[model samples]
Target: MFRALGAVLAAGLILAAAQVPATADTRAPARFSEFSVTPTSLDVDHPTATYTGRLVFTGADGTDQGVPGARVCLDKDGRCVATTETDADGRFSSPVTLSSTGAQPQLRDGEAEAFFNGDAERQSTFVGSGIALHVTQVQARITMGFDHTPSVVGDPVEVSGLLERQTPDGGWIGVVGQTVRVFVDGTRIAEGTTAADGTYRISTRVPVSDEGFWGVETPLPGRGYPYTVAFANTWQRAAHRTLVTGFNAAPEPVRKGAKLTATGRVMRVTADGSTEPATDYPVLQFSADGKKWTDLYEDHPNSQGYFSLSTPAERDGYWRVRTEDWPDLPSTSSVDYVDVGYRTAISGFNASPEPIAKGRRLTVAGTLKRDTTAWKAFSGQSVKIYFAAKGATSWTYEGTAKTSSTGHFSHTFTAAKDGTWRAIYAGSTTYVTVTGPGDYVDVR
Candidate 1:
């Protein structure tokens, strides 16, 4: 019996030693070297933009670690900007400012990388892997037409709109109590705050300009509230409570072969004797037949909001002139068409270098093929050129010249600088239509 008991004890001791808790050799310290952010791209169209709401970092072993920091720096083209960091729960938050000119505030194309000293005891850098953010600023619409040319300066001009806010659903959330800042030629002029109804009223002195219209910028403060920039002149009036307005300022008609240049001032008529210039608006020139037209000039509104555009030679037919409203003024025409002449079909012709490079001589040259070869020449057809730029949607006339007796027409357009450009040719009484969307070219 004693020998059997001793054998059982020896077997139990051997089993216990085999199980020995797998030994200290099986345990090791963790090491990592890689990190990333989520979503991969940041879009800046809304003032209140957010990432997937998190920063995700990765390690050399493909393991994830949360980044901890209240602030992160991002550089664009050379300008560096900072964003706030996450909270203790591994979340960071920050307000994005969209009004910095040096930073390329339009968030659509801006980007940055996030980094932090994470787990200092391990000497590891917590960096997010492959994260993207889409951010944007809220847009503001100013009341009145493109050119405000009010007949008087210092009169109370009512400006109203919703302070747009952005929501997490990648959409806009309209809010009230936003501040509207007024600026003229890059200078602050006045400010007003929006009410609960998302509207603002401001009384300000008009900036000095040859034309009454002034460049106006309204910046709303908050996360993702984009700065709004616009122009207003005194020549046109708001038709009703809605933002729509009509250009009451008419062009002084000119006749063909006449030496008289079309010259005039644009003003907005008000109940009071006050007047504002239409400089912020562009001056348009229409052909006598009213079918073909050209833009002549864009002038800055004078302190009194006044502007004038002159044609060097006498105009041949009926011409109309006006500024373009934001959101585009309702026009009877579709697809930006113009009639050139009789018996020739010139369709799908696109123009290039909109606003026709300023000071640089531009050749308004494009392929001109008539459906019917029987129509040999587009002779003496009046080819008119129009110009505009980023700030100016309204077209201005650079110059107009007639085509030679041959079927081909070319005009030397000399502008003061580079801008968007388009051209139209008036052939006989019929207008020629361009074939496709106008082309854009950079001369500089």
Candidate 2:
């Protein structure tokens, strides 16, 4: 009876053992043979980078073998940010885009890792012991230009430009609502905020500088981006400034062949808005049509910034003063228009028959001459005959006479009463009006 019972028990145990499933894995353990993240440094603009490595397992024969179709992942701060499956050769490549929140705290002080979760056939492991990465803020650049070239002193200068940040693909995008500052000769003068389009405009009256070096920049500090980098090649330029006032050309209706004087003040505007006499010279220029100009003369200003230039009047034109092109100062004054008329005279006047009967024919004659290099006959001119009663304040107009080729004019009129007779020549655009000497004519 005992032998029979043992046999049944052994059979039952064998049956139970056969029904139970196997729990042990027959595949080799898996691990990363090699793993690394390209371009250890990262930034907000270029937040994405690549991570590549190979997943391998120890083979049954004790040689490492490729673990094909295995999964691998990139871990950052204990979180899986990117994942990829190994190819036929156990190699895997995946892109990792860092989040702003993830990158902010790690700016200049963070690292990334590669991890793998164990599968049914392999044990879990990671290969990021020596691999390291860095997260950094994006690079910024400023491009700008002055609204007006060659700015004037004591006047506002407007500077405008776009602000941009570098991208991961080497492209650029505008940085909106950022503050930008302007500097003149290394001194901060103005600042403004960017618009939605990344454009900004700043206007300010910069102090005077001999070199006149101007530039713009964006400083990154205490603005939530401490690691942000600003390019050294910010927008820079060299410019000049000048101030000229109180310009005048005297003798508005200047007579031809007479001396005409031009006066003005040339000053330098200091940083404090004070004016002082500039040591530069002033050039006197004349323009016939106000479009083209000719340099007439130049002179230095006195201690009080006053200067005077004299020249002979020649024709109707415009005049202006231009500050000499000095390395430190340059400027131009407002234009002044001058009217110059030619000098004219009347000679050889005669009125015949003094103390005669009334209603007699009277003759008036005169020679009209224009003064140029020398006095010459003025032809094709009209002359009027005038008469004034004895001791009268004004003269009475009679008739007109045309001048001959020799500039001699004669007019005959019927006299009525005793009066003084004279010939007058009206002025033209190029000549001045003149009256001939009066001759007494009597009519009874």
**TM-score of each predicted structure versus truth:** 0.27, 0.39
State, as a TM-score between 0 and 1, how close model 1 is to the true structure: 0.27
| lDDT of candidate 1 over 54-132, digit per residue (tens) | 4445556876555544344433323444555555534655444433221124443344444443343233232334234
Superposition error at 372 for model 1 (Å): 93
Global local distance difference test of model 2: 0.76
For 1-444, candidate 2 gives per-residue lDDT tens digits of 999999999999999999999897665577888888777776665667688888888776988788888878787656677788989988988887765431123323355677778787778788748456665667678787777763455566688888887777888878776777777777778888778777889887755656667777775542335236342223333323556788889887677878889998887766557777776788889999999999988987888878999988888899998886554367889999988887778899888766667777777888888887788898898999899987789988998988888989898878788889888877877776777888887677
Model 2 TM-score is: 0.39
For lDDT, the strongest prediction is: 2
